[model samples]
Target: MKRLLLFPVVCLLLQFSYAQSRDEAAVTQAVENLRKAMVDGDKAALEKVSDDKLSYGHSNGNLEDKATFVGNIVSGKSDFVKIDLSGQTITIVGNTAIVRHVLDAETNDGGKPGTVHLRVLLVWAKEGGQWKLLARQAVKEPVK
Candidate 1:
């Protein structure tokens, strides 16, 4: 009797284990679009993904507000390239979500070509039924 009750519960949980939402495919699509936007440096997409009061922390320890962060990309200052990436984990809880993504990026680094393997933690909050990024922090790990 105990095993019979446990089996259905286990199966039900497995069905929704992917993420906090039933529509995980939409979240994946949203993340992919954001990556493309960051790589191509489309200011519009950047703005769409972020909240008005966004806090951005760079891998180099520089911090910028949402406006400054978007402006830098629009002005051609910090550019993204070679954005090879892997599994992105997104967790939605109530009205907030956190996305963890691992990316291998090649950058001009303001005239010096550099490559970095980093994980980005992006905090998102659902405001007016739309997910907006509240904060983003990127940390680089030395790859062997």
Candidate 2:
């Protein structure tokens, strides 16, 4: 009798672990999609991956709404020539996923070239069965 109960509990635990791993993979893909969109300046892709009420925070303490974030990329005001992400971690809690990573990027905004290195935190929420970016905050990394 105890063995029978233990079997069900073990199965349920395995099932839940599998589901969480799947969600983590989905959130990882969403983050990759957003990175590509930012580099390509694809307005449609950007809009698709981000929530309607996105709160984007820059390392310099600037904040932008969804429209401004999309528009800046599309208009070349915030251009990402290349982006490399490392040390990424994703944690899922209910319908929300919190992601953190180090972002190193080359930028050419308004015809001036520059580089950016920052630690970024991203919040993604499952909406309509898709993971969409809900919020982001970045802080400059210490000089190395």
Candidate 3:
């Protein structure tokens, strides 16, 4: 009787782990998509991947809503030359995913060239059968 109970519990744990792995992969892809959209300045992709109620916080303490965030990228106010994300980890809870990563990027905002290194935290939510960025915050990291 003890052995049978343990078997079922182990099987259930394995199944849950597998499901979690799949969710992690999906969230990772979503993060990559967001990076690509930023680098490519693709407004449509950005809008699609981000929720309308998004809260995008910059390292400089500036916060933007969905429309402003999209508008900045679309209007050349925010342009990413190259984005390199590393040390990424994603955790899922119910329909929400929390992602943390180190972001290093070359940027050209309004024709001013610069580079940024940041530690970023992103919150993504499942909506309409897809993952959308619900909120994001970044803190500037000193370059070594």
Candidate 4:
């Protein structure tokens, strides 16, 4: 009798674990999609992956809303020539996920070449069954 009860409990725990993992994977994929969109300057992709009320903050303390963020990237005013991410972590709590990573990128903003090294924080929320970027902020990485 005890074994029968334990079996159901174990199954429920397993199901919950699977669901959590699935959400994590989805968040990871959403992050990747955003990276690709930024590099490619794909306006539609950028708009699709980000929430309408996105708040993007730069390492220099500049802040942009969704329209400004998307417009700058799409217009090549803030261009990302290449982007590399490392040490990424994703944690999901209910419908929100918090992500952190190191961002090393080559950029060509306003026709001037540059590179950036920063630690980034991203917040994503599940909306309409899709994970969308809700907010992002970056801080300069410490020199090694």
Candidate 5:
């Protein structure tokens, strides 16, 4: 009886771990893609990473829709460079995952390199079997 119970417990643990791994990979990749896109200034990449009607709340309290965000990058209004994720935590609960990435980044607006220490909350949803960013809210954490 003890062996049987232990076996089921082990199997259940493996199943849960596997499920979590899948979700983790999907959302982590999405955020990584976004970072790369921002650094490369590739507006086209947003087509896959972001939803059509996405809401973006910036650290500076600016709100921008999908079109505006992409347009700004493509039109030379915004530029990001040397983007590096310092400590990132991604968690998935059902179909929703909140990704927090604290990084050092360089922006054209004369911000400290990665010292921006942005605490970004990225919301991703599974749509048609692929995960895409539905919303993002961020706050600039003070440098410690």
Candidate 6:
């Protein structure tokens, strides 16, 4: 009787492990999609991947909602010339994921060009069976 009960518990644990892996992979893909959409200025893709209540915080203490973020990027006001991410890690908890990465980018926002190196944290949630970016915060890294 004890062995039989243990078997079901083991099976459930294994199933949960598998589901977690799959969800992690999906969230990772969503992060990549967001980067591509930003560079390509694909508003449709941005809208698709971002939650309606997105809170995008910049390194310079600026904040934007989903509409403003997509609009600025798509309208050449917040243009990203290139973005390279390093030291990326993703952690999944139930229906939410937390992603951390070092971001290096060349940006041309409002006709002013600059390069930025920052540490970024992103929160993603599974909504309607899809991963969507829910919040983001970036902090400028000290010069090395």
Instruction: State the C-alpha lDDT per candidate.
Output: 0.79, 0.98, 0.96, 0.97, 0.82, 0.95
RMSD (CA, Å), each prediction: 3.6, 0.7, 1.3, 0.8, 2.8, 1.2
TM-score between model 5 and native:
0.85
Model 2 spans with C-alpha error above 4 angstroms? none
- In candidate 3, stretches whose alpha carbon ends up further than 4 angstroms from where it belongs are 142-144
* Ten contiguous residues minimizing lDDT sum, candidate 6: 20-29
Judged by TM-score, which candidate is best? 2
Q: lDDT (0-100) at residue 50 of candidate 6? A: 98
By lDDT: ranked, best first: 2, 4, 3, 6, 5, 1
lDDT of 3 by residue, 1-144 (tens): 999899999999999999899889999999999999999989999999999999999999999999999999988899999999999999999899999999999999999999999999999999876999999999988757
Model 5 over residues 1-144: C-alpha lDDT tens digits? 999889989999999999999889978888889888877878789767888888989888999999988887666577786678867888888888888887667677433333366878889988887888899998988767
TM-score of 3: 0.95
Quote each prediction's TM-score. 0.78, 0.98, 0.95, 0.97, 0.85, 0.94
lDDT of 1 at 129: 62
After superposing candidate 5, which stretches have Cα over 4 Å from the reference? 109-115
Candidate 1 worst ten-residue window by lDDT = 18-27
- The CA lDDT at 117 in model 2 is 95
Candidate 3, position 8, lDDT: 92
For candidate 2, what is the lDDT?
Answer: 0.98
Per-residue lDDT of 1-144 in model 6, one digit per residue for the tens?
999999999999999999988998898899999999998999999999999999999999999999999999999899998999999999999889999999999999888999989999999999988999999999999877
Give the clashing residue pairs of candidate 5, or none: 104-114, 105-114
